[model samples]
Target: MSSLNIATRALTTNMAALQVIGHNIANVNTEGYSRQTVQLQNAGYQSTGGGYFGKGVEIATVDRAYNAHLTREARITASTAAGDAARLERLEQLEALFPMGDKGLGSALNDMLNAWADLSASPSNSTARSVVISRADAFAARLRDTAGQIDLLRNSTQQQVGEHVDAINRLATELAGVNRSIIETAGGSHVPNDLFDQRDKLLADLSQYAQISVVPGEGGSANVFLGGSQPLVLGTQTGKLAVQRDPLDTSRINVMFTQGALATPLDANTLGSGALAGTLRFLNDDLSAIQNQVGRIALATSSLINQQHQLGVDLAGNMGGNFFVPTGPAQGLPAPTNASAATAAATVSNPQALIASDYELRVEATGFSVRRLSDGTTTALATLPAEIDGLSFSIGAGPAAVGDSFRIRPYEGAARNLQVAIAAPSSLAVASPVLVTPGTGNSAGMSVESLYARAPSANLTDPVTLTFNADGTFSATGLGPGNPPPDNPGPPASYNYTPGQPLQFNGWSLTLRGTPTAGDSFAIGAAPSSAIAQNAGNANGMLALRSLATFEGTALSDGYVSLFSDVGSRVQNAQFSAAFSSNVATTAEQARANVAGVNLDEEAARLLQFQQAYQASAKFLQIAQSTFDSLLQTVGR
Candidate 1:
């Protein structure tokens, strides 16, 4: 090679190097921009007489400083962090509805119970009765409000899912366009560093919404897959994503990917990491469970209270009515798309045994299969009134077809439907129906103690007589309108009347204390008409409700507390996970940036090195030009 050619090659290589250095410094602060470096190689040598003449350096290619492994790790971590953050935000909103301490649902339940206790102290006190009613209404209102808020949150989450799907579709389309551009620009020999940076930025943005896997294709194009398998982008062809309602559960939202003629639905379990996955999980898992739990408390409270209230007599001598409106059963009609006209209905068989869950009934060739949504427990269909977990299932009028199915949400609206049934204070039942009296001319000091009418409707028009005998045994004569009618009618049934022992007969039990002398007797009969009808001081029935085991062998108050604890624990766990994921994502991002990101100091030093090289290359060109000029002058002379 000649001096002029060598100098020209050197000058061109340095100029290209300087330009690459300038580009790097200019994009130092650009997000997702990888540092660019100019590769240099020795130019080809020419054969000479003695040896091959050396040639100057030439520019090979401009390469991007990007670590694929670190970049992938960062993207994955970012996806996890985004999902955790989204879930944590929703959990915080839900947790806010259940404020702890004295202002929460537990406190509301306790207040209602305490009002009941106060009413028991003065069963006929108008103010006490009104207070009980007011507290009950307040409690129901609270549950309704909480349930309403939860539903609103669920709807909001669904809307957010739709919006994120739209964004994913938009980004996928843009990425495909970039892929086409990169292929057209760098298909021959070199990597399009700027286009590669643009594609990487798009990938990072896409990862926030969904877990994506990118496969490098020919001609610098990439094929992106969602959730590892569903194709999103294939070599300049973009797939669209959409949010649709789940067929089985109308309230649930599902993400669908459409590529060509095929569409696939993605659910929470299959979607490994993304904001969309987190929102779906919260809506389907956490929010639904919380709503069901709240509804469970409402149902249990109403059922138990109504049961106990029915067993008591009001001040008007009338049977007590339901204290609170019981929750109605959930029925599922045939789906609109079902070809067969099959329907199913559910009723609460035993409220005490109810589990907080939804159920699905599917008609099979043999019969029907019922599965609980919460735990996926299945049972074969039985008779019309088949009972399971406090629910009674009944088939509709006609036989169901093989493909017919229905979803039964037993507690879906329980909380919202809870209300006080009794509006009047006089309707409160707080008295017993039977009374006991000591016989006349008794000297044993035995008195009428506690009495409970186990069978209030039993014929008790005439009083039973219990006489203490000298042999320490008692004889009971059936005196309650018995004309060969009473079951226990006999010739003086005899029994030992031990002190402090309950004397039980004729569906009534009485306890007597102290010593009983001979001829000492007691009478047990229906309470006097005036006392039964007008007495306003009896509170025994109301007091008994305090210790009543209402739900799942637990008191109503304790059940509410348990539900509150569960929500709080879940909120705490979600927050912790969000924080941990955020920390990990930050670390991964830092590691990636260390490799691909540009530093001002480093770029400045490169700028100086390139500038010096350019100056040297220019000086060599100047020397070559001067040598040529001198040689030309000598030739002319």
Candidate 2:
């Protein structure tokens, strides 16, 4: 009876082991299936005079070849790699917008300058004026189009963020359900290997949506957290991610985690590794940089051109009103939660000094201060009306408030807002408003080389005169002594005549070349019809703008070059990071696979070994039955 009982136990235990081996072989290609094996232990021993005799083998719990650390590592690398790759993909799209050669912004700028140069050669030529208008219109159209494309990209990114949030909520809910099932199925007595594999696979999938941390819970349950240990799934309950408009910039979308009635916003900078984090990073960092860069160029170029154009007379002999529609002196955006009706506005005080960054203006109990958002640097403000970098900030409709705050993005939409206010060829401002008049009583040759108007002035509106003395000296005054006062030999108020030298005063300057004899006089004020038709001074000034170092002390075209090259370098770096991170993710997965992944050869060998054991157990049962029958026969005899 003892022999038969031992054979029965051995047969049942070995058959169970064989079944586990077959299971392993069957699931060799399963994604998250860990290699499993049946554990064995000796059955209860029978006490006898010769010591203890074993009752045969008993099956222990089945164990899986899984390592928690390896799975975690694989999850982390996968999350990070997904982020890097997604950011790189979007960066490539932005890079295409900058291009090179004739299709680029640089080409557009060059064409604009060339059009002005053509107008300078023939200031009254209708065709030349039309070309200038066409060029300006084309530049404005191109800028508006580029700005539109950038906004579209941002819209697309925000939509993706919404999708990711939805997916994250779904994953968290599913993981919570899986946690419940796992806890119920694995009731301390038995280890649910398939459930564990399913849970691990869910974790890996969740990590791609947002970075997550997993904590082991009672009864084989996993508690998951997202964006810094905020419980996404705790026991049987789950949380979800939601999206919202940024408090300051409504155009930007932000992520939030919600559970029950509690909602926590995820900081963009600290969202950690995930596809969603990468997408948000692109939206905040790369997208804003491109918008600022492009808009800065538009604002600086257009505003400066308008200023210069205003100093000139158009083909119709009218004062130029905005060659390109002026941008800003703009109202700053108040925060959503501002305490008062106080308002602020910003204007281009100096385009050359403008930094490509947004600013935050906040009012404390004592006073108000502004900060550059890009690097968290403070810019001083003397009072409600102050200047920072190149922007003039002033209060609009404010009375009082302790925590009143505003967002100032002076150049944010400047490109999209670019327009040509002057539509006709007759409106091209290609001539200086003031004319240079040589006296008829001149004794020698004297010529006006060039003229530049630096600012508006009453003296410029009135006649200003330069009169040559017999002693190689000249007197300059807005008074009629030189305007009608072309006389003076005194050295006290007169300047010594120098050829090819500029005579500057009252916000305007002029270069004079050649010998100046006694009684030679020049006057400047209202432009004659011939002057408006013949003079190309303002057109030359417009052409010279191409080389002006007004964009962060770099030429306007150079600013575009800087932006293009900078983006190119960023694209290259992003590509390398994407490739390296993907490789890292692959290597990490391979490392995890080495331990928990199914090996068909190993499983086959185990199958054979277990088959042999099963055969031996069967034989033992047969032998036990034969011996018992023999003993019964003897007893019968």
Candidate 3:
């Protein structure tokens, strides 16, 4: 190679090195920018006819000082971690509104139950009734507050989504600008590394708002998808996304693209590792569910206590006062028919409208009676004893009557301390007076209670005489008390093995095979026995007030408290899990960033090296100049 060629090669090599150093320094503070380096090699070979070689320094290529594998790993780690962290942050914010343990919904529910129990222990105490009402209202208020908080969070997320949409569009515009610059400057075999870096930065920023996939396109460009196969940006053009209310729930916002309202389904999984996904999960999944559960508890508690308070007689013997006014949404009541007055009496066209699963009614006439509406069964109550059946039957003053009318209420078995027990007789004969046996077994001792519980049969034509002597012994003689021979003609008789279980007690049952004479006397036992007692339905047509009872405050029934506690536990666990996952992902992302991060000190060293190389090339040119000058002078002499 000639000296001119060598000098030109040397100058070009120095220039290339200088260009790389300048580029690196210019982009020192730019995000996503990688330091560049110049690759040098011998110039293209020129072969003489006989295997000779001539060469000059060649500028091979300019490449970025980046580890592609490490960069890719870092991106994946950072993207996933960012998504999780964003989601967890949103959840934590929501959870702050509803704390766990006794101070939260669980405690409120427990307080309401305790109040009810106290009222049951002292049914006539005005203070106890007031306490119950107050506590019930507290529970409802908590629910209302929780629901409000959820709404607030949901609305906030929607606002953020709107702002994010605007941001994404702006980012798209910026990226498009970068794309134009890159295409103009270095679109072909060589792309401007800095401009490409700017574009990549925009892409990474846009992904934080939504889930995106990118595909390389012609002209060193890319097509971006918002979700699944929905295109948001194609080459130089960008798609628009708008925030709109969800059709089903106006409180929520949905993201939709311009063409045919295309949208990426916003869910925890789809928005997998981005801020938008986190906000969506918090609003739709976590906060919404908490609101629903709390609302249910409130509606149930408020409706139940209010209904019971209406039915129960207060200390002043007043009925139908406000016990616990619900603070949540107003409960829809079934419109009353012309024939009925009570809430239950109103015909319900839609069962879904029923807010509470409990019902109660207390009727006090010659005796007191309590009923539960949930299962439509009456419980024969004996609070203060009253004279009945030639013996004293106890019943409480129960609740006061509003005029001649009585109110029926549904009881929440899980929320109160009251329990039910059915009483029935064990024998079949009427020789003994009715006895109180604690109702037990399936269907509350169906056998003994069925006689009265079921409608009486009208088949027996003959009048059966029950002879109760002053002694305990009792007998059934002729229809008119005229004693006849054992073989005299009479109606057929039957016998009952158990009192509540009906056997044809007419003479036919006594003589299943043999017919009983009309005047014949049959001995039931050496002593008096009793027939099965049935739960007499309330005077009203509906059996919706039979499962209620009064009990002490210390023993509350399994009701709203348990349900509330369960809800709190679920929320706590979900929040904890999300936070844990977010933390782990964040840690991993930080580690990856540390490994691939650019160091200013290292770039500074490379700058000095390139500068020194340029100076050395300049010195070589100076030596060649001085040698040429000296050779000219020597040749002239």
Top TM-score hit: 2
lDDT of 2 by residue, 261-291 (tens): 8988988766787889999999988889888
Query: Which ranges of candidate 3 are over 4 A from the true structure?
Result: 1-12, 22-29, 44-58, 66-77, 100-102, 117-129, 186-189, 260-272, 315-322, 325-605, 634-637
Off by over 4 Å in 2: 2-5, 48-52, 435-449, 461-505, 509-526, 626-637
Q: Candidate 2, 206: how far from true, in Å?
A: 2.0
Ranking by lDDT: 2, 1, 3
**Tens-digit lDDT track of model 1 for 325-412:** 8666687846656667767888876767888888888887777788889999999864455898888887776877787888888788
TM-score of each candidate? 0.85, 0.88, 0.59
- lDDT by candidate, in order shown: 0.78, 0.83, 0.47
What's the CA RMSD of model 1 in angstroms? Answer: 5.2
All candidates in order of TM-score, best leading: 2, 1, 3
Cα deviation in Å at residue 266, candidate 1?
Answer: 2.1
lDDT of 3 by residue, 1-637 (tens): 2555666677778778777777767766666776677788877667778785656677877876555455544555556555556656666676577665666766776675655444333433446545644665666566656666666677777787678678878887777677666657653666566666666667677766766777766555657776566677776777777777654344456766675545554434655556666666666555554454444444344444444333322222222333344332121122222123422221222212333322233434554443333245555554533321111222123343432222222221121222111011111011111122322221321222211111112322244543222221224543322223333122333221223222334311221112222233322211111221121111110111122221111112333344445455655765676567557656654554455345667667876886787677677777777788888899999
